[model samples]
Target: MFWGDLHVHTAYSLDAYGFGTLRTPAEAYRFAKGDAVGSPAGDVQLDRPLDFMAVTDHAEWLDLMYTCTDPRMSAHPYCVKLRNQSTQETGGTVFRDFVNPTITQAQPAKADVCTDDPSACDDALLSQWERMQQQTNAANDPCTFTALNGFEWSATPNYSHTHRNIIFAGDNVTPTPVDYIRFPEIDQLYSQLEAGCRAEDGCDAITIAHNMNMGDGKSFDVETESERTLALRTRYERLVEITQEKGTSECLPDYTHRESLGECGYETYITSHSRQKPLADFEEEEWERMRSSYARGLLRRGLLTYANRQDAEGNPLQVGFIGSTDSHTGLGGYVEEDQWQGTVFGIGNFERNMSRMGFNPGGLVAVWAEQNTREGIFSALKNRETYATSGPRIALRFDAAKVGEVPACKAGGALAPIAGGTPMGSTLPEASKAAVFRIAVTGDKAPLEKIEIIKGTLKGESYEESVIPVWQSDKGEANACVIWSDTEFEPAAPTYWYARVTEVPTPRWSSYICQEAGRCEEFPDADVKIQEHAWASPIWHLPTR
Candidate 1:
């Protein structure tokens, strides 16, 4: 099993400065090492060392927001406007509100800066960005610690659209990172990378979309500008961060009442901070507006719907799942209570220090790979044989096949199939004699409770769902190997499969800290807050053959 964090920020990111302490790439790596044990901002640290880590900071302007605005990088239209906006009394507040929850009202206000000459931006920022990319690649160390070349493209349409983080598997690539500032729209950016990769040898990349819930529901909109046809969910966008520091982007408590209680009540990504309003009071309905949009996106177009839509080519597109901490702090794998590093300094802190804190401990990206190495881990991630936890090195594997399933440990014959064959995101050509589903979930000494497969399928034009609780380590509440076998299938169901693992109880970081510190009131709600240990695979959607 390999452990890492795919979503991380460094001083190179434009927004990391106002919140974090670490600035340089080497400093970020050291910070991760220190934060792996703990930090002052809050609970952050990994119980174990990571096999790999990707320092994925925002690509737009690359670190120019903090640097170009230095007045040293030369005065450009965007930089000048950014400097002006940064100085505004309401600037930070407005920017923070647009983090994950609400639409950014700031862009429209800044529209005037780029209105006259958009190409003016092209000439001004390119050199500084190239230098930053040079620095990022120079910091890569596959021998000492695995470094993933990656960047976050801040592409949000109306505060709601697919916001993706692109990561490369190897160090040798060409050109530099291209974020929203350069290309603005995702489709255009996608076209650019695809063209570049096809033209070059040994050039490959993957994009992971995160915080879809915050995107006013447009993140998963299957359609392009023309609503007549569904957009293409590319194989390039293989993974989605279902959970993050902003809050779990998996499911909402209110909307997903019947399925499972989601982490919805937590502080939202967007608030009216820029408008002189405190971050304390939250409007539930306003939050629901965003959540409702997300649910609607899922319903109107099934998970990864854009992927398989009929195109000129008969090949289908596929998408997968992973979780990450959008921690502005440079530290990665920080999720322990005693060691939590604020996701956003002063903002992520649940306990008020001076003001609102955006800091949540850094998170980890988990993969079940053959070995703990760069190529091994990268291969696992690209193949979608991976899962993510807020922070923990949990090993989980799920498989669906023609014959009934068997454990990798108990299957006895060979574990080679687990490697050669696709486990999670890859699909079977057609339904077989008997569909065997197998899941092996292990926690970091945390007692296992349940493991189940949540499945959704398309029936004709309408979609239907089913939950198969195939394994439960606790039978009537005792430790046992909880496993199940299902041979029956609704012949016509266009099925997709993924697995989830739960702890015996819950392990909310805040609750654990309060117990050790003997401070309950200092916390919010304990009973409602239990740290869950789980992993989800990419949905292997088997559309009707």
Candidate 2:
């Protein structure tokens, strides 16, 4: 399977400055092609190249970094006069605020192209946008690389958290992103984009929600914090990023206090590198303290829905998960050995240092697709046939049926059962009084080991559950299958089930190489004793009456 890091930032993003590498659109594409870290001008290369990369720099002050750099643009007498500092430092002043400046500061200072005229903004901005698009298209060589046009929409509702990354599939067409839409609310942005796409042809876009842990307890809510019923959320947001370079979005210890130990403490949210009151600060161990609360919240919201009646549409708001590295550096440096080369902090530069550059080589995105092409990859993401990793591409397959049931599907052959079976993230209908879950575990060709199935239930008003060791396949085959039955399931138990496939302990990238071996020595603090391979089944909930 081919690998792709869907979320990334470029120099166009204000905060990306001095974070080791500051790459332009063209430079970002080259960095991906070489599978390397650092800007086009820097020295490090990635251990493994990504098949595809999306330069999703922020859209708030899109391309401000480049515009401010051109003397012809920034040195306009009007622009120079408005600045308290020297004209050369205007860019830093505009972007370096403790909190990003609002849109009022976005207009040109003069009256003409060279004199701070609003039209000048168009000249510099439009050229930069085209440059970004051209570079993305230039890097698309199907056999080796795919470059996607994407940008992050910063939507902090009343300064709370509600950010999303918007990505596009085809480079053939694009909208002349308007200035009035600058920093609009998330719902409005979604409406604008959806309307724009329908006006054109073959334009497909998807938004991935991120940094939600910082949403102050409202990121995953069914309704907007303002009590607005955002019907478009169900239509626009197709997936949730559950893991990233800074932390994992899986259940936190405190959120899942009842079943908090095993997979709870893996990692937390990505605090920005700046020490000046991190843009979004919270206690380091907050994940532990908030785990149970979060899970309870999820259950509370989920249970409110009735058995048959749905939302405005016949469909329910499906809460599915996927993972990605919110890497400021263009590469998603997920592997420990390659972490130093793939992330921003890994760049050997002292002057560009920031506290948030506290590097942790964590997380990757995995999808179950028919092939490694653009269409196939996009389909997996849209259908939620994807899983995130703390960084190993472990293969996991799961199916549920009655105790005596066996699928006719197999991985090989023209009409093999694999083609007819449901993979992880799929629901199994009730076949009998009890459901017998079957799973197949395969290590990332690294090691074979054990598997876990995390189950939850609502006993009336309270929810109870357990992570059962359903499958314990040996380290014998390249892959192994396990069958287990839970005849004890009560007919009245309000239940939901999911699987976690894991690999046997294996050598981490650090274990195989040391500093003297011309590689970074210590595995990142973010690196944990990972079992290489893991699979998470979709939370199969029976239904709420």
Candidate 3:
């Protein structure tokens, strides 16, 4: 399996550039290849080289930044305002003025910047896009590393984040990346991709939806939509980012306490759209809306709603899972807990007691591909044969087979699919009475604690979920495998099951920072040690098909 990061940003994103990241697209790829790249803080590098990466800068800011940063336009008043007032070191009055009301609020381009020439604005955006494409292609090494083409389409309305990262399979990409400036709603972005990428042969792309925890219920709003719309959405969005710098979108404890007890209460920061208040302080309806903002919650809600929405492809709700760092520092796969730098460290001076309290070191994506080439990695992603890890490069394989079938072990200790069975992120054939699931995990450095099989069943628009502990290490076993049978499985129900592997308690990134700074007592509740874990994509059983 090859480890990689598909979501990252460079200085081309004006927001990141304005904040402090100076690393260019080439520098970002260099950093991911285990090279030391200069950060605003200092020289930063990942301990290990990533096999594949995609530098997804913000698409909305490409033109405005290109227009302002052009040497020819150096003396223009608009460019001067961008350089002088917007950058954090200078004053940041203009950056705040630009980002909030215009970008996150999802408004039109600033009139002063775009001016009267709409064609010129389009030209500038296309120029930046082409430059990014060229740089990505140049950095790609089918012999050494795979650099995929991608960009972020950020849509944050009313402080809610409903964003998507567009990743192309190969050189055949859209002439222009669809951005929120033109496609305000998420549906428009998908339609544009259909028209741009899929219109031409040999061109294919998929968008990874992320930060559903902060999406304020708009990230996966499939309710009241048509069947064809669901099919289209399922076709375009094959993966969901399960964990990231913001927090775990897998599940939160607060929702678990009241609803599904999925044991998902770890690193759950930034829970609300309005403020940094806890879920207890939120209104009942607003708190209820949070069910749509988590991965597990999305699965549960999918069971409730997507019963009849299965397309010719499969259920619209079944999505592959992956993780990545939304790091603006242009540092890909920099997810080590020991070598820590805050996400928005302008000069490495992160006030941990303040905004940094909610953030972590981010995560990585692991794909089981045939080779280390772009075609290989993108094929793995499209096939939904991928898993996500929280910093550690834990190896995992989850598979399901009929009760009488036997699971095999591959050469690399990975679990091989049974003769007539399905693997993770796949749909199973109709079962007889029960199904046996084989789960294999190999922890990195840390010892294993437990492996849980979270199962959810749909019965006429209402669902029930349970967490079944399949295996737990008594000794300090960092590696183990188990074939657990669901004796109580119901053949009539449409269900989904996935594996969650937890490690022994270890210090969080905040705890490491506090230990180094000798400020453990300063942030009492926030700096507690955490159990880092990995999540495999779900295997589903759609009975109606």
The predicted structure with the larger TM-score, 1 or 2, is: 1
lDDT of 3 by residue, 17-132 (tens): 77756678988888888898766457777778999999999888888777877423545677777676644455356556766666666775445766666677688888989989
Q: Which candidate leads the pack in TM-score?
A: 3
Relative to the true structure, candidate 3 reaches a TM of 0.93
Distance from true position, residue 345, model 3, in Å? 4.3
Tens-digit lDDT track of model 1 for 218-258: 54444443322123345466677766776555544443352
Give the top-scoring candidate (lDDT): 3
Q: What is the C-alpha lDDT of each candidate?
A: 0.54, 0.53, 0.78
TM-score to true structure, per model: 0.77, 0.75, 0.93
Residue 175 Cα positional deviation in candidate 2, in Å, after optimal superposition? 1.7
Tens digit per residue, CA lDDT, model 2, 97-126: 411443223332222324435565666667
* TM match of model 2 to true structure: 0.75
Candidate 3 regions exceeding 4 Å error are 70-73, 86-95, 253-262, 309-313, 345-347, 352-354, 408-420, 431-433, 525-527
Better by lDDT, candidate 2 or 1:
1
